[model samples]
Target: MSYKLSRRKFGQLALAGTVVSGLSYLTNRALAETPSLNIVGIGSTPIITTDQTTIPEVNTTELDSTAPDSVSTDIKPVGLVLQSLITGKAQVLADKSTPLLELNEIVSGFTSLSDGTLVVAITPITTSRRQATPTRITFLGTPVKTLIVSGLKQNQQLGSLLGTNDGRLIGLVGKKNGTPPIRLVDIDLQTGEISSISKVKFPNDERVSNLAECPDGKLYTSLVGLNGDTTLVQLDSNQKKPIRLGQLKVNGQAWNNGLQSLVCSATGQLLAFGAMRYETPNAVYSVDKNSGNMTRLQDFDTTQITRARG
Candidate 1:
């Protein structure tokens, strides 16, 4: 079979082939660069205690070297649920509910360091109140290292842990018995010491429930009132106070539920786990930083997720 093609025809065919190859290269490059976000969540079932009348506090001050070699006798075993989600999706990709430390500890806070190391604050369950032991900070990895928080007061507990882009760990410290003031502080990863940053003055009835740092290095927090009203506030590092954005709204209607966790993806998308009303299962939402609007993404079953980090 002998077929002769003109010069113009051959040129057209060559150009078409080049265009197809270029398109394929571009597509592959995009896919390689834009990896799916990996969000991790840690939670647990409610802690139940058999003792009611007399409660005892576990002396955590002595057990601060590393993760306990074995589960303490005072611990009432409960499973700690660890789950993961991909970017732009609400469905959990995997639910590996492993009983780390025999599920004897309650996860009070969870966040990732700048190098993607998972850090968790857990308190050993000693009584029904769940407040008889000091909260210890631990790193989750091959060998879990439990570190003692040196500067935290006996009545203060740290929550809403946020790892900043500049490699600093920040958290919200609140009182156990009385109303909590807006106290933001920086925590030392090596020494487990905490130093006070400037305090944000918010309303007495409202508290800074959750905190997240965006890709641009700006910090945002959710102010939740006693009536379940949530407002998004932006904290500027240059200033001492935070700028109130507005009340959070879903589909243009005011959101009536509280946001359990707030996290910003590497792609600059703000995500949250919100407490929906009417007994509906908790769901994930994409938050609008400018207007305080939330768009529901997908419904997730876990309700006790203290925080999520992407």
Candidate 2:
């Protein structure tokens, strides 16, 4: 989804890629105070690491997720991705029947503000390709509506995007003719305003494949492998050059390099990427963020697992 600027923030230049790359619906009024949420994990498809950040659908065949609490906000999943070809506009699919959140083209992506208030990115009415504005809902509960902004404009079209603990900044991608395919944006997390620190692009940055941010707000972009390593570079705001590392890929795509993901801890632990074959059931490993050591998170087949976009 895209975000807002009072000038009409056309978003989704906000949606589309990391280079690229879900479902459940259950609505209940006053679900806010409900004790336990009824959730299901219908399917767990392994989305292989690609050049883009992939948001997997939360398949709900049957699950028992914690219901809406005071802090619990229900954002119905609408599976969507932008096409590189751009012939047709990107589409979102609400595969479920009655969802908690009702989004029209007027809406892009949504994230929760830690405070009680809802801050959103809105798409300006002037957006040519899409209809929705990237705005935030006042309350995700009964009578859901958008929180208003003062003097918001159209340049804000690349509306507010939610972030993951892993450091994926979910906002719009703004592109111009001959420019790099994607532009990284920072969301204010409040008021839904776009930051002057708005766009980020790398040299020869073709399409952003997969991106992961560390707990420290440092971001790592996953690129198709070149040379000896499946690469993920660390960007330094002060320095022009990035710190580079070589990740080992167990998946077949690493024929040229290794499959990679990066993680960092505030306490100074540094965990680089490593993978083993997942025989059908995948084994997860946690790298020592500070030491670069590997520890197991879950056990699965590195071999049974698949390789993806180089």
Please report, in order, the local distance difference test score of every candidate based on alpha carbons: 0.59, 0.32
Best by TM-score: 1
Clash number for candidate 2: 88
Where does candidate 1 clash, by residue pair? none
TM-score computed on alpha carbons, candidate 1? 0.71
lDDT of 1 at 175: 66
Can you write out model 1's per-residue Cα lDDT over 100-125, one digit (the tens) per residue?
33244556567887865567776554
| Cα displacement (Å) at residue 229, model 1 | 0.6
Query: How much lDDT does candidate 2 score?
Result: 0.32
